[model samples]
Target: MARPFLYRCPITGNNVQGLTSDDAAAEGEKSRLEMVQCLACGGFHLVDPAKGPLPPVDDK
Candidate 1:
């Protein structure tokens, strides 16, 4: 089942909701980066699930 997660957008600096797939949900809380669509910036941002609700992505 797909689940919702909160992540921070580096571009917009806003908290956004991200939907996870079955594969991701299976991995739950693992230290990995996942690309999430940012509604505020309308772009993609890398989010780490283990980093809590506010995931930070490197701008570099």
Candidate 2:
């Protein structure tokens, strides 16, 4: 099973939520898989790209 991870907003330092593999692939103009804007600062980040590649799994 994958583990849960946490990230902080670059602009506000607020706790950001983690992303799942599905979330990464579904990212579009309005959606993203990385550090989303924090309600406090509205800053965004790319989260952990170097963590490693995602495992193979069927789309939900």
Per-residue alpha-carbon lDDT of candidate 2 for residues 1-60, written as tens digits (9 for 90 to 100) = 434556655555456555445343434444345544445566555766335333444447
Error of 1 at 58 (Å): 14
Off by over 4 Å in 1: 24-30, 55-60
- Report residue 57 deviation for candidate 1 (angstroms): 11
TM-score of 1: 0.65
Residue pairs with backbone overlap in model 1: none
Model 1: how far residue 37 lies from native, Å? 1.3
Worst 10 residues of 2 by lDDT: 49-58
Clashing pairs in 2: none
Model 1 lDDT per residue over 1-60, tens place: 876888777777778888776564454554677887788899988887556576465668
Best by lDDT: 1
Candidate 2 lDDT (Cα, 0 to 1): 0.50
